[model samples]
Target chain A: MVSRIGKEIELSPVEMASRYSSRALYNLAAGSPDPSTIPVGEIMNSYDRVLSDLGPRALGYPGAGGQESLVKEIENFLPFLGLSIRKGERLVVTSGAQHAIELIAKYLLENEVVVAENPTFVETLTPMKLRSSVVLPVSLDERGMSVDELESLTRTVKVSIVYIIPNCHNPAGVTTCLERRKRLAELAEERNFYILEDDPYRPISTGVPPPVKSFDNNGRVIYVSTFSKILAPGLRIGFILANQEVAEKLALLEQNDFSTSTINQYVVADLLKRGVIQGRTEQLSSHYGRKMKILVESLRENRLDDFNPPSCGFFLLLNLHKDADSVFHTALTKGLLFVPAGPFFLRGGETYARLSVAVAQEEHIVKGVRVLKEVLSQD
Target chain B: MVSRIGKEIELSPVEMASRYSSRALYNLAAGSPDPSTIPVGEIMNSYDRVLSDLGPRALGYPGAGGQESLVKEIENFLPFLGLSIRKGERLVVTSGAQHAIELIAKYLLENEVVVAENPTFVETLTPMKLRSSVVLPVSLDERGMSVDELESLTRTVKVSIVYIIPNCHNPAGVTTCLERRKRLAELAEERNFYILEDDPYRPISTGVPPPVKSFDNNGRVIYVSTFSKILAPGLRIGFILANQEVAEKLALLEQNDFSTSTINQYVVADLLKRGVIQGRTEQLSSHYGRKMKILVESLRENRLDDFNPPSCGFFLLLNLHKDADSVFHTALTKGLLFVPAGPFFLRGGETYARLSVAVAQEEHIVKGVRVLKEVLSQD
Candidate 1:
């Protein structure tokens, strides 16, 4: 007998594309990098050295509480983000930021109200919704999650958790300002609700902003960051920082989920410990910075539609005259791909589409924008 | 505010250990292999080669379904376990087998009756309970999940899922016979319940037995396996083979989570394709086999406990006379560590404990068993 839930799941956009399209069809949709551009050689070298020290078991099940060296290194890494958590108090290595998010949902949100930005990364919403938590979307503008809206909403919704992308917000690439971050932290403290600060796109930019964790005094903010964007995503390495209470809950959740790859954490920790990641971050920021410039300048030159490139992260939100889904479908035929912002919105999302600058090369940027110009001009 | 569910959320014994004990004190409670044992050097070689060929993008967000070559390798690897599904039918590469198990719980079991062996793996039971699935524990003997009990239960309860350890059962180390596998498969077909054939330890045993998936002609078996035990768990690479309907549903669930680490998959596929894993498996089997024998025979010679060395896998189930928790706690004081078997049980699991012989060296096994014997002799 087929499961009714099973029948409801639509095939993912990535899988469908693999069947119809040929040869890595410009994947701006899934918010992944152009694989050819990531620095695999250096990572492999670091992996080689780490494996030589750790051996085969490094690849086996990681420690239930994460490897000590990695946790310690992460502890060291957190200070740079403006949070000072000891390895034991606040750090955990997860399979990905998604796992960390899910753990927080499982541990903290118990059929309670979860406030998320209206147009947000859909994956972040999965854990909360799956847990049967009442999801209340707070509308976001170019300044990230609107604090005023959140403040107003929390007063009524009895919010259990607030999921925010403080840095270069996904699908919208809007970084929250320091004042907003402080106000949001204040609201979370006042409401006595936990804040899940997801900042996966942090290292790709030169500009440093105060994290929610930086403002957290009562240990309410659980900061989640990933090496996936900076080092690589396939490593499945992400860590969360919170108080011991939250870390313990996450540790318990991870204990059941199977701890993240042990060696992946080791390899990453070794890289972080040895300053390999910091060294590479310089190259990564420059690369994304150049790509962001290329995308913004090209869109302006072509005058495709009203669009603004934010200061950081991988994507830009384009204000489209036509429906985002129709533009996405038509652009596929013309070999230009981008995520239609319609799917990002839980409430109503019709006028905008999200384009990733991470994978768009200079040549592709020129060609893609021209294609977008032609396709939009036709309609 | 503390979550109402947070206070209510149950944790496995290992999870409790992670929470209560210091990291050093919690060593033996967790069943994950020591990170020091992973074959990092060999995997790093593959990582280097892959990186040279593809670069950093390989580690970025993976193809939503899975990496193509890695999925193909997994497809190739599956026939050995008696599963013959098409390339894209119902196979998904997950973060780990643990994640795959949770995915099944999410999609298949909807508070429906699930039958697992008593003294089961905690990770398996955690997700089932988390989903509020009605869990019924079948008894286990030296031959694995008691088929007669399972058959009788399947007939009575409206069973939707049955999780089995066809090779070497975790905690139990009992390998079910081929006849029982066929019986289990027939029961699944008869009752229309899915069999979750978890075989992480299958590759570790030189003495291969018939798997339920091999006998699964009716497509009721969703076979799961991982390189975690054999290669590296930290790679967090595992696969689930089911029919097209089941596979597609799991794929959507995975897309919601982080897609399997792409670069890890590529390196794993390379290891498989290049014959590295095959060579490593032989070495591993021989090495862990010797360690297993030493631990078993020593236990017999010392008359320390009533336990059998696992026929295959890396673990041994000890049925102790004293309180299993106290016995384990005392052993840790003696600087000897092993997982207490209480957490493995679905229902009654207080009297048993699991010791992994895989990681303990031959000399350490002799010394460890001597310590265990002394501990048992005390009082």
Candidate 2:
């Protein structure tokens, strides 16, 4: 029988996305990962090597956990993020970070309450809602997730899982401070609830911050990260770090779902072995950093002063003087689109917008902000 | 407040996949689109040249509908499948076929009953389950979904959706005959339910069979296909074909979830344009065909007479002389692992095992079958 949750579940946001045509106009509404920084050429070369390594056998299905070489490389990459995951502790590769999020939500959550950051990545809330979770949004400030708000929410609501983007949040682009992360981890320990620490933007940061998973001495934090942002998003590769019990459950889930794209794992592993990933990250940081400047310059030139400059990731948060809906519609007419922050907000959204710095050219950045300013000022 | 549905959703199989090690023993359980076939090298080259064609300004987030060039290519590809979709009708790149499936489940199904083929792809059921749909498994014979059973169920139950794999059913490797597809399509029209035609393996088949979608003159079939099977699963690229109304609704659903991996879409479009996809498909078909022979040869040598040979796809169903579970355990000891078929069955799963002809060397095939024999002969 179909669960009762599926029957009653309905959200218009996803439906809105389906109607979107990439050819229609500027689509700033989507929080898609940036590809300009993807090390495609190097990854392709690595793919060739991986194919050569596997020979004819590579064309077939891959091993259970993932391609060993890739998993080992993932293990190697974990330490760089300050996570101390043992090889035997469960680490599973997924289609993307979103799939991992869904998996955790399905397993740990039993239609219980989940506490999440308000104004969070709207995509994160969908799976939780589908599962019939009572998702209460924890408030956030400049320092990232409000630990105080999280504590209060947990005290009142029995939360089974807490979803957080510890480093460089999506849409908001706010990084949690180290102290807050420690407090958050400590809270999870005290509450006896699991933490899904999403860190897709870790490598893209201008400077690294210690991950919440790094402070997880009690195995409460299941650290999830993806190479899609660093190497390629299209590859649809991501991993999760968890203890054996949770890992085993997830594996059972994966056994039912399609396993992670195996050949990509092999090629990614090859890239790690060849030290291409390091070079790629460095190159990407420089490339996207330049793109970031263009967007920032345009915002400054246009005197759009209400926005916050992001420390990392591909987006900037714009606090417009006018209502976001009117500005969004006006900007769309002018061929410039940006994601409205209303949907991202857990509590009904106020007047904030998200602008991606990854894809725009230097001139458009200037023009986009000018158009945004024109729309906002008029409204 | 998070939507009630979000909190009640279950963990996904892809998420659960994290339990095992990537580098571990031989694994026959994976539906990941092979990544080596992505033509990443070609895409890298296209990335180099896109600047020249579309110019630097053309590179951004791309139009929300999709890259015009990529959608046009899909236009060309659809005709081969006998679909004549009009331009500007809703079309978008998705994360993968599985994602497209989930999107459809979210939109069209509302507290409804979904009829799926028994022993079908487990991932297919995950989204349905998460959506709280009552999943009624319709049994499958060698000719694909049993028509008599479907007709009987529809008469007795109120079903909203039916997921059918007309060509090359996963795990089972059974293709629905043209007659069965016609009957199924007729039933859908009579019952006023939508048919989700999932055909990830249709192209890989040596002989073409009429697609269930092709028979749908009434637009009841929302056909989903992926580049994952033909290109790379890591690219996580897939598409859905449906009437404008259904497509529009699904587009909205997509807005809430993660958008299709844009970088991967561009890469696929570029590969298709460069004509690299043609060579890869040929190579893939040839490779799998030969591997099937190796698998068949091994079975013949082992004198395993209980299994039926699959006409297409990479799997074969083996009927053990005794309970398949004991054979599964014994095979594990010999390091010749195949997914036990008990999990595939919806009602009873003790009699069968599923083996993939896509991997394993000829020698391993012989040895693995030999191991199966030794284990089975114990009785």
Candidate 3:
């Protein structure tokens, strides 16, 4: 029998798509980066270099937090994003950003209120909901999560953490404005809530503003990011930057499963040392940027309901003039697969659907959008 | 401030040792395979082959259960150990056995009684204890966890799961007899409890009996094993073999963090295809077997209290005639680092200590045992 928490977690759309069939013609369901841009050669070279140079040390346990060299490399890499860590602040490498969220939910949000955007990442919301915490879903517009609503909610609720994807909100793809980021940081100080800034897409996307942590003066922002989008998901490398107090606790909690993959840490460290990640990110942004443009232009030509084009990240949220479920099933019949945005929201997301430009090629993007237009026109 | 679960978890001894310094002369404290024995060359070859052959597929998401190719490889490998899976039986690859244990404890043992051996793996106990479940620590004699104690406990306490390391108990270094394994499996059915048999050390160690799962007829046993001990910990590959019902649920639960490493799965699959693991395991058993013999002889010569020399696996249990804490401190001064087995037990473990041959050289094992003898003689 599944435990209460286990029952609360459902198979995400990406998982469902993979299980259904490997023959799906247009895969807009998964928010993964283009597999073609994974830099397989560079990764293979890193593995060879790490194993040969470090010998067996690369295969040993990487300690509780992670490999020290990798952590230090991550520390060195952070300054490039306009974020700085003080002496007392610390970092803990996790399996991925999803794991970072799970650890935070388990360690920091017991019987506390967690505020998030109404239509947020479904996977992200699952961990918070499993905690049985008070999840107050604030609405998000083009400028991102409504701070005015968050402020009002904080007046009555003891908000512990506000989970935000500042750069490119998953499923919604709307970036929070700089002014709102500053206000959110200030609200965290005044209301005494922590900000869990999950920013996996920021590094590999253009027009992403500085992270909320850059505006955080009180160490209330827990900055998290993953190399899955920029480098490769198979590496399972993600890191959390927080104050020493929280970081130490997270490190201890990580002892439950030992460390993340030691070989992965070594490979990531080697890549960072060689400046491979920086170069790859630039190439990825250019590639995905083209895909995003193609999807946006195709959608506009189809005379669909007006929607904001994603400035950065994998997804584009389309506001539908009709029910999303019918459109989703019909598109599937047309050999197209994309996640329905309804599950992403706490309420009233039936009028919205998300298209991911991450997995599909430019040609597939056009074909998938045409299928979507046909499905919507049928309704 | 940390939440309840975070507060309940503490820095394990292995973690403390690693964080204390990277230059520890003797790392007998951690039960990790000797780094030098890691098949780095083979692993490098696998990586090169996987990247060149599978390309981006190696770096893509591995779905919920795992890469089908890797799962099939593990399925084929299990029959070599006298274990068979029915059509309904399933397997889920995890980050490691430790993670598999955590998942089981989280998904299956909530608000239930979890009976484990006294002085069991400290890391294994943490997840069950964190669940706030009633953990009944049964005593273990040379034959293994006293099935009589377990029977008596189950009769009164309604145990949900009996966590046993059937082949080579971690701290005690004793194997459960074949008769006892069969009895334990039968008892699980009679008592309506599940048996979580963690056997990571079984494959690479000689004289270890076939897993208790071989005796399991009614699907009451959930068998979990990791490649960390045999292949390399850095691979973070482990698999759970359970009945179809439980296997399906475990796969769904794994979706909480997407899946394990895709590249790792491909690499492992390639290695299995090439029979690298089979060969490496033979070499490892030979290597560690010699080390185990040396440590046992040195301890016997120094007149340590009578204890079971492990027939298989990594550790030796030394019953001390004096307090183990004092010996532990004194041995540290002499450049030896082994875990005091006191923490492994719930009570009366002050007189026991564990020496691991897993990470130490034969010469260092001798030197460390001599220091242990000197420290114990002082008391």
| lDDT leader | 3
RMSD of each: 3.4, 5.6, 1.6
Judge the docking of candidate 2 as incorrect, acceptable, medium or high: incorrect
Query: What is the per-residue lDDT of model 2 for residues B121-140, given as tens digits with 9 covering 90 to 100?
Result: 76666666555447888888
- Per-chain TM-score of candidate 1, chain B: 0.91
Counted clashes in each candidate structure:
28, 63, 1
Name the better of 2 and 3 by TM-score: 3
> Compared with the true structure, what per-residue lDDT tens digits does model 3 show for residues A1-379?
4577766667776566655435568888777778888888999999999988988888876567878899999989997767878877999999888878878887885567788898888787777777755678999989998999999999988888898988777988889999999999999999998999989988797667789999888889999888889899888889999989888988888877653788888899899988889776677888888888898899988887478878877888898777878787778888888877888888778878888888887898889888888888772
What would the per-residue lDDT of candidate 3 be over residues B1-379, giving only the tens digit for each residue? 4577877788776566555334557667778888888888899999999899988888876677778899999888887666878766889889888888877777885677788898798887888778846778898888887998898888788788888998767988889888888889999999988999999887787766778898888889999988898888888889899988787877877777653788998888888888888777667888888988898889888887478878778888888867877777777777888887876786678878788888888888888878777777673
lDDT digits (tens) for residues A51-90 of candidate 2: 5565434433443345666778888877666676765577
Worst 10 residues of 1 chain B by lDDT: B20-29
Compared with the true structure, model 3 gives a TM-score of 0.97
**What is the model-wide C-alpha lDDT for candidate 2?**
0.67
lDDT of 1 by residue, B1-379 (tens): 4443355446666555544334332233445554455666677778888888877656766755578898888777765554577444567888778878877876875556778888777767777665554778898787777889887776667887888877767778788877788898998888888899888877666767767887777678888888777777778888888887778778887655663777788889998887666566566777767777887888889875576547777677877777778877788787776667776876766767677765555777788777777887889
Answer with 1 or 2, whichever has the higher lDDT.
1
